[model samples]
Target chain A: MDSQSIATTPEELDRSVLPHAHEHPAFLRHHFEDVGQQREAASFGMWVFLLTEVMFFGGLFCAYLIFRNWYHPAFVAGSNTLDITLGTTNTAVLICSSFTMAMAVYSAEIRRRGQLILFLVLTIVLGSAFLGIKAVEYHQKYVDHHIPGLDFSIQEFVHPSNPKAIPLAPDMAEKTQLYFFLYFAMTGMHALHMIIGIALLFIMVARASKGAYTEGHVIPVENFGLYWHFVDIVWIFLFPLLYLISRYR
Target chain B: MTEKTQETHQDAEVHVVKPPVYLAIFLALLALTALTTGISFIDLGVFNAVIALAIACFKASLVVLFFMHLHYSSRLLKLTVAAGIFTFLLLISLTMTDYISRAWGMF
Candidate 1:
C-alpha cells in the first residue's frame, strides 16, 4: 500500500525521489535498519562502556580492600579524618541528579519536550552542585595538610590541637597517606565521570532542542539516563567506604 | 500449519510485558539508599562491608530491572548482560585472590 510498491514507472519514481532523499542527521548511521535499531545499539554500547568503568573503579577498590586489611588501623584512622557530612550530602545530591535524569528520559518517552529539557537542566545543576561541594571538601583537606603527596603533614596526628584527639603511631600515621591517596584517586575518578556526564548532558540538551527525541526516538535520553544512574551508584559506594566506614570508632 | 505460524506463536509467547508503575521502583531505591546510609553509621564489624555491598547490589538490581527495562528484554539480551557482569566478577575475583593472598604470606 506504500509508494515503494507503486514506483514502477520512471515518472513515478522521480516524483517520489525528492522526499525519500531527505537525509537523517550526520550522527545517524546507515547500518542500523531503523531508529529503534540505532537506539538499541547506542544503549548497548553505553552499557559496555559502563562495564569498563566498573573494571576501572574495580582496580581502585581492590587496592583499597587489600590495603585496608593489611593496614586496618591506619586506614580506619584515615577514614575517621574524612568529613562524613560532606560525603553524605554529595551522595544525596547525586541521587537527586539520577532522579532528574530518569525524569528527563521519561519525559522524552512521553513526548514532553519542555519537561525533558527542564529535567536535563536540573540534573546538570545537581551534578555541578555535587562537584562544587566536593571541591570544598578537597580544599579543606588541603588546608589541613591532609593531601597525600610530598606536602602531606603528620604534625596534627602526632601532636593534636585537642587533648582528646587520638595520637597515631608515627609509622601508622605515615601509612595514612596511602589511605588518602586511595581516597583522592577513587573519588577524583568518580568526579571525572560526573564532569563527563554533565558535558554529555549539555550535548543531549542541544540535540533535544533540535527535536531529535521529541518524536519518541528517545533512545539517547534513555541511554544517558543509564549512564547517570551508574555514576550515582559509584558515588553511593565511594561515600561510605571513604567517609562512614569507621566514623564511630 | 507451517514454520511461519509456529514462529509467530513463539514470538507472541516471548514478548515482554512492561510494569504498570515505575514509582514503586523509585521509592524502593530511595528507601534502600537511606537504609544503607543509616546502617553504615552502626558498628557491624566485618559485616559492614557485606551489608553495604548487599544493599548496593539490591538497589542496582532494581534499577536494571525497571529503569533499564532488562526485565522486559529478550532472554538473549539478558544473558549477554549477565555474561558481561560475570566476566567482570571473574576478573575482579581472580586478581583479588593474588593480591589478598599476598597479605596472608601465601604468595
Candidate 2:
C-alpha cells in the first residue's frame, strides 16, 4: 500500500542533496527554474516576435492610409474593381482557419492527440481555401488589366464602362495605379505571410502526428496559434479597407 | 486530493480556454464580418469607413484577447502589446500631421 501511494505522487523525490534535483520535468531547460517559468519565458519571447511583425505590417498600413486619402476618387475606383463576393468569402475562410487553429491548441493542452491532428488538418484545408480564392481574384484582376505597370489600362475609368458609372479625368484616372499598387503590396505581403504559415503548418502536422505537442509540451502549438490568428486579424482589416470601401457607390 | 490541488494550481497559472468559449468567439466573428459587409452596401458617407474600421478593430480585439490568450497573460506581456499599439498610433499620427500641414489651406 505504501509503494502504490508513493508511486501515485506527481514527482519522485531524489536522494540528491541539491534542492532542484528531480523536481523539474525533462522538458524544462537547465536555465529555467520549473516548467511554469519555462512556459512564461517562451510565451514572452513569442509575444515580442509578434510585436515586431505588427510594426512590419504597420509600415505598409501607414503608406496605404496616406495614398488612400490623397486619391480618394481613385481609391474608390480601384477598390470597387475588386470582387466583394470573393473578398467576403476569403475573410470567412480565414476566420474558420483561425478557429481550427485555436481548437488545435486546445486539443494539445488537453492532451488529445486525435483532436489535435484533426483540428490542424482542418486549419490547413481552410487556409488553402483562402489562398485559392485569392488566386482567383488575382486572375480576374489580371484579365481586367488592373495590374499596375503591366498592361494597365485607364480606359475603363476614364470612359465609364457602365452608363451610371462616374467618370474620372485622365489625370485622376492615372492615380488608380497607386491605389492598385498599394492593394497588391498589402495583400501580397499578407499572402506571403500565409504561405510561410502554411509551410510551417505542414511541418507542425508532421511532428504533431508523432505526438510532439500532446505530451505536455504545448508551447509550440500555442505560439503558432497566436501567429495564425494574427494573420487572420490582418485580413479582417484588409477586407473592409480594400474591398468594402465605397461599395455603395 | 493533494495531487488534484497541485494540478489545479499549475493550471491556474496558465488558463486553458475551453471549446465553448472558442466557439462563441468564432460565431461572433462571423456575425460581425457579415454585419460589416452588409453595412457597407448602405451609403453612410465618411461614416461608412468609420463604422467598418470600428468593427474591424473590435474583431481584432476579440482575437487578440482570446485566441492570443492576452486576457489571461501576465501583466508584463499585456503591457508589451499595449506599447506596440501606442508606437503604431504615434507613427501614423505624427506622419499625418506633417502631410496635412504641408497642404494646409490649399484645399
Candidate 3:
C-alpha cells in the first residue's frame, strides 16, 4: 500500500477526502463508498434478507391459521398432546438467549471485548439449551406417535387417556395429523434457524474473543443480533399458537 | 488481522443500551409467558386464542422496539420493518377472506 492509500482510517474516511485518498479499515470492501455507508448498506441488506425470511415463515403461519380454524377440536386435541412444561421452558430459554444476544450487541457497541465474548458465549449456551429441550419434546412426540407422515397415531385424540382430555371423533382425530404436520413444520423450521444461529454465534464468539467487533466495527455482531431476535419473535408466536390453544377446554 | 487500536465514533453513533433495561424486558417477557400459561387453565370461551395472541404480540413488540433498537434506528429502517409485518398481515387477512367466505356459502 502506498503512503497516501495507507492513511484512510475510519476517521479519515469519514472526513473530506478526494476520491481514493480516504483511508478505511482493512475489512472495508472496495465497493463501499466508506465505512458508514458500508455499515448502512450492510444493515439494510440484512433487513431485506430478514424480510424474505419473514415471508417464508409467513406461509407456514398462514396455513396454520387456516387449518386450526377448520379443525378447531382436532387442533385443540393435538395441541394438548404437547408437553406444555417443556414448551414453556423452551420459551423461557429462547427469551434468555435473545437477552444475551442483545447484551452482546451492547457490549460490542461499548467496545467491551471481554464482555462481548462472555455475552456471546452465554447466548450460545442458552440457545443450545432451548434446542436440547426441544429435542426432548420431539422425542416424546416420536414415542407417542405424533409425527405426521410417520407413525402418527390418532388413538390419543379419539380416545382420551386422561379424563380431562379434549375429545374428538375418529374422523376429526384423523385431522390431528394435519395439526402435527404443521406443528413439526413450524417448530422444526424454527429449530433449524436456531441451529444455524448457534453455529454463526460460534464464529462470532471466536472473532469477538480476538477483539474483532470492538473499535467501531460492530456491524457483524449487530446484524446477527437482529437475526437472533427475529428467531425469538417467531417462537414467541409459536408457543401460544401451538402449545396453548384452548388448553382449558 | 487488523488490531483494534482506538475507540472511534467516526461516522455514526452506536447506541449502548443499559443493563437494567434488558433485565427488565427479560423479566417482563418471562412474566407474560407465565401469565399466558396460567390463563390457559381458565377457559376464556372463544376469546382464549385471541388473548394469547394479543399477549404474544405485546411481548414481541417489546423485543422489537427496545431490544432490536428499532426505536433508535433510522426511519427507513423502521419503515422496512413495518413493511415486512404489514405484508405478513396482508397475507393472513387476504387468505382468510377466502376461507371464511367459503364457509359463508360463497361458492
Per-residue lDDT over A74-193 for candidate 2, one digit per residue giving the tens place of the 0 to 100 score: 888888888898999999999999999999999999988899989999999999999999999999989989999999999889986667567999999999999989899889999998
What's the fnat for candidate 1, on a 0 to 1 scale?
A: 0.21
Residue-level lDDT of model 3, residues A7-117, one tens digit each, is 224454344243455656655666765576666676778888889998999899999888887888888888888899999999999999999999999898887889999
Off by over 4 Å in 3: A1-20, A30-33, B1-12, B105-107
What CAPRI class is candidate 2? medium
TM-score of chain A of 2: 0.90
**Model 2 steric clash pairs:** none
lDDT of 3 at A46: 85
Between prediction 1 and prediction 3, which has the larger lDDT? 3
The full ranking of all candidates by DockQ, starting with the best, is 2, 3, 1
In terms of DockQ, which candidate is stronger, 2 or 3? Answer: 2
Q: What lDDT would each prediction earn against the true structure?
A: 0.73, 0.84, 0.83
DockQ of each: 0.33, 0.52, 0.46
Off by over 4 Å in 1: A1-29, A159-166, B1-22, B105-107
Error of 2 at B15 (Å): 0.4
Question: Chain B TM-score of all predictions, in order?
Answer: 0.79, 0.86, 0.82
Per-residue CA lDDT of candidate 1, range A1-249, in tens? Answer: 011122223443345444555544333355654444555566667777778878888879878888887777678777877777777778777777777777777787777778888989999999999999999999989998899885999887776564645777898778889999999999998999999999999987876666656564566677778888888878877876787666553
Model 2 off-target regions past 4 Å?
A1-23, B1-12, B105-107
